[model samples]
Target: MKKIVLTSFALVGLLISTSCGNNKKEAEKVEVEKEQVTPTETESTEKETSESSTIVAIAAANENFTTLVAAVKAADLVETLNSAGPFTVFAPLNDAFGKLPEGTLDGLLKPESKETLTSILTYHVVSGEFKAADVVKAINDNNGSFVITTVQGGNLTASLDGDSVILTDSKGNKSKVVLTDVDASNGVIHAIDTVVMP
Candidate 1:
């Protein structure tokens, strides 16, 4: 009977020691993890805060994209484009829209024409982030021509003309990229000289 009692005490003491040891180990591990993660989290938060402007926000701030902004609003795609897409947008400047045939823009802005406008807008956006260097590399590596798939499920042929990037739409219409790599939180924008068709 005494042996059983002593054994039970011994077991209880052993369990207490083991539990204490495990708790100590967990505490140390948590501290180390917190230390490692804190700096990275802080840096990431600061960077995101600094670059908080999204593609829609950036476009809205600029006067050059006034027509494009209006079209986006008319199409009700402003929210979609403003999402966390990491999209690559080939933005058309006001001059580019002005190059459209007379009364074309007016017709497209009609409520009944929203579907076509949405298609045209989404055609300008690729689903992923692609910087200027990556684009150039892709073009150079692919025999000086790279095909970029747009969010609209159509493809745009990207090729270099001297030092400029030319985007040819599925309709075989050509648009010259004027400004490259306008960074946004959700994506990047490359201004084109013409509003390419789907």
Candidate 2:
């Protein structure tokens, strides 16, 4: 059988409904360099004590994920990402969110847009853990492409771009995975260059 990963979280689907159409507007190619920064050893270890943290913590600690962290809060998904049982999150960096058309971000952040925002965020998440190597293997095993079902009931197509993993969202937007295998106590995060629409 071809390798295809499909995980349906009925409970998660119950929590989110309705996708925002406005987010489908043509997006600019965000400059990833502006979003990521080299972490110094001291800042990297912020605390001398060794304590396992969750995905939310890892994202909150990194300046590159500021926008993502805020969106999680806005969507009230901080607790979900903090939970156990390894999730695979295609996290978009700050500049990725910046790529959205004008007013799109602000509109999604509004209280009225919570449902749409929740669906959009969850669309970037997969139920189980999938490392970069795992994704690559699955794609190659499935004849250069694999379709992954998101928690939101939307599908994301995973394929290869040279050595990189590319995710094509429901809206046909493509995001290149720039950073992968960011392990957390709860899950792993792969940073992407664009915000994939649901």
Candidate 3:
């Protein structure tokens, strides 16, 4: 009887040890799977952020548009440009702002010049999203020149100048679109070489 009891206890101990070992192995496998999945989830999140960024966010992320970003903020148009409805923005680079006559940019940023600044900034924007291909098509359909109405209630003439899209502002100043079709969640931006004033 004593021998039988000892054998039974030993068997029970062996079974418990095996069960614990299996549970530990399962726990380790679950941890490994979680580790592998983390990076993929992070990558997906980053891609979504990039794809959903608005026009202002896209411009803010680029280094070339520092001046443009500043001007947008100064003009109090950050929210308007960030909203939905698919606007077409003619963005000017820092170099374009630099080409302005001395004190022009500084003067525009002044508090009293807010209305004037807003008008000038709005002149670069259109109501609907027009891609480069669409603009080209419009120009061709219009017999080499297409007139686009600005959000500020002025007209800009778009023409092709040797494969480049040129914009003639209300003041008769001209700007060349250097880069086109910068996609944004709210709109698209075409970078111009000069600021087209209203």
All models: lDDT? 0.93, 0.86, 0.93
Clashing pairs for predicted structure model 3, backbone only: none
Cα deviation of 158, candidate 1, in Å: 0.2
Candidate 2: minimum summed lDDT over ten consecutive residues — where?
20-29
TM-score of 1: 0.74
Predicted candidate 3 versus true structure: per-residue lDDT over 1-198, tens digit per residue: 999999999999999999999999999999999999999999999766845598889999999999989889999999898777589999999999999999999999988998999999999999999999999999999999999999999999999999999999988999999999998987899999999988
lDDT per residue (tens digit) for residues 141-168 in model 1: 9999999989999999999999999999
After superposition, candidate 3 runs with Cα above 4 Å error:
1-52
**Any idea what lDDT model 1 has?**
0.93
